[model samples]
Target: MKLLFLIVLMYMFDQHKGNRLSNNPRPFEDIKREISDYSEVAKKIINLAVYGKAQNRSYERLALFVDTIGPRLSGSKSLELAIQYMYKALKNDGLENVHLEQVKIPHWERGEESAVMVEPRNHSLAILGLGGSVATPPEGITAEVLVVTSFDELHQRAQEAQGKIVVYNQRYVNYGETVLYRGRGALEAAKVGAKAALIKSITPFSINSPHTGIQSYAVGVPKIPAACISLEDAELIARMSSWGSKVVVTLKMGAKTYPDADSFNTVAEIVGSKYPEQVVLVSGHLDSWDVGQGAMDDGGGAFISWEALSLIKDLGLRPKRTLRLVLWTGEEQGGIGAEQYYKLHKMNISNFDVVMESDEGTFMPSGLAFTGSDEARGIMKEIMKLLKPINITQLFGNGEGTDISYWMKAGVPGASLNDDITKYFWFHHSQGDTMTVQNPMEMNLCAAVWTVVSYVVADMEEKLPV
Candidate 1:
């Protein structure tokens, strides 16, 4: 494979050399000039990000935010304080039009929870109640365990699942496939008269740490206690049951849901010099789950977005269209804050030229996943040429972040920073999500890419075609 790839590369290079030596060489000068025009400013952005290493500031700020405010769960007082911190910080940084937009968010608390193995040997298991799950009775519920690899298996053994604790030992395929059990395992188990559901952490690898995430109960289905157990525990129960050994477990939870609480989406901007009404928006969610410090999952994303605006502002560079930064809340609860923002500002949706989000962890810059028209793609291709020095040149199509999907559906262009996501799922929504997972250089590179993209797009003469 390597030799074939080398041969193909050599052939391509020789073809390029042949074309360059031909008398009828293509007019590549014009394209080079266009790239240079954007590259001039792009160089400065990269320098600022590289030399300044803005990631250090972002990391420190995230550390402080995590230490001081910690776990910005939607509707929690900590989340509210985090919003206030950013609101004041943005204003103090001299960003224009800094303010907060109100959003009501669901408040769910995981009071106390535990799972224990009773039969086959008494042992305690690591567990975390799935967000939005109902509580077990005050004493708890104990039943024999019924393990299934998929919903199909559960259905096949529906009769045996009655009055048992359904254990989903589904193998980790990919996030999109494995997450089905986390999102609907309880509902599926309830349909078969199970007393409770225990899911293997949705991550591909684990260290006896359970990952917790939001789960939704289907309407008209019975609600039951659902939680995640360490991958080891899930496998242990699966093995025991496979040996025809009776495995019984006891589950107890004090989880509760309260009335919706008030929150806000913090907004800041650098008004455009030519067209103030037209906007280029970049954002990341400010809220996270109640587990880790929320550093890698989204703290890095949020701070890098802020750092992009800060870098441009410090350089005194103003785009032709407004550059707006929105720190969203309730994203962990399914993009509640972004949805509200869209509804409130959708009337002027046409004014938005592009929307970009960075929810994926800030590892290293690969490129961007973009969604737009062919004309817009052409424009972006030329613009991305400016990023060649930083090794970011790919332009993927038909991909956008959850928070900006609505805007893209409304005919606005959308983009998301593409990076090395190999380890992202390992730390995502788990206690492993912390500042230790981030690197200063990689985060600065991300900030540089975001700054250049937002600035150039906002300054371009033509709006992205619909």
Candidate 2:
């Protein structure tokens, strides 16, 4: 009977991996039977995470991690300390193959920065200098303000922008659509000879908060100071400019870009019981903007991933394929660590089955956004069904994340946790991103889903179709 069961399992994996279901559709009952084993494991995971002793563990861990090591910006000394903190934490957790791989990353400091209205009004404007922005002169750059809502308007009034400070008050559409202004506001402003650029915080909702993010400089174009201003202040200046108000502002930023610094991608894993060479990768970047505690931006995501491995270990369950966790560095400054990881590991791309990243807020998880073939989606759907106990079982088609997109584009199956991120951008790259934005119960649910999906995918005999 045992021999027959093994033979049947091999046949099932063989048929599924070979994509035989395309020509031959099996009955739903057979599908249920095939996934029944996973359902049992999922129940155990839910119980451990939601009800057992591990409840709220991820949230507590995240709080400790972030509280101990506040914002971990790229190439900062605090970031290096944050890496050591995780290195010790993971080893203490009893995870196997714990180590770090060096990756060179950029270093930029947000020195003393401030902006104030000198003419028309003397109200101090809330500001946070964009990363990689050059410092303004010690005396500061006081210029006439040229308020424009979009790039087109800037081009339309190019003559007015010359020698003026361009304040971009672009309306909030969405993060992806609106964040472009934050990234390129300075480059565009410099084109028309603007001395500096101030962008409105890219959030639909804000309580007088100034956000900061990375800004890229074009080759051969003069670099100008770029910073994010509070929505209220930007709108104030824009409204003043609209009513024929001459709003002169003085912006001072001590920002500077140093040479590249050392960094590492912290790693830990559970070696497979069977095929140790095959890996199911899970990740969250450890680096964050030098703002608040960074609990919401990524501390929650990183700890939940750690919780996944911890839960499996506590339950004494090892998957058939290795489940590797990578805490990436330098993600905020444009995926500096993950990009190197991809270049280093792409040669063994076939060995990687799935790459999962959680850059989006770790709010109450709803389901997953996945990128893969139809057959792979079918497998993912079955796995998600096991998460029904947590009341999250819907899978979306578009799987997108900054760190994991590289693997997805290269045809490796990718998955990103789908959660209620309606307010993700509100705290993103800002001081509002702290433990107050995270819920313990929500983190528990997210950890459960992350663990269940990663475990089942690793243990399942069938390989996800590339």
TM-score of each: 0.92, 0.94
The clash count of every prediction, one per candidate, is 0, 0
The regions of model 1 sitting more than 4 angstroms off are 1-35, 53-55
How much does each candidate deviate from the true structure in C-alpha RMSD?
10.7, 3.8
Write the residue-wise lDDT of candidate 1 on 306-424 in tens digits: 99899999889999789999999999888899999999999998688899999998998798889997767877777887888788878887658889988998888899989999999
The true-versus-predicted C-alpha distance at residue 411 of model 2, in Å, is 0.4
Candidate 2 wrongly placed segments (more than 4 Å): 1-32
Model 1 alpha-carbon miss at residue 186, Å: 0.5
What does the lDDT read for residue 66 in candidate 1?
A: 78
Using lDDT as the measure, the top candidate is 2
Give the distance in Å from residue 56's predicted Cα in candidate 2 to where it truly belongs.
Answer: 0.4
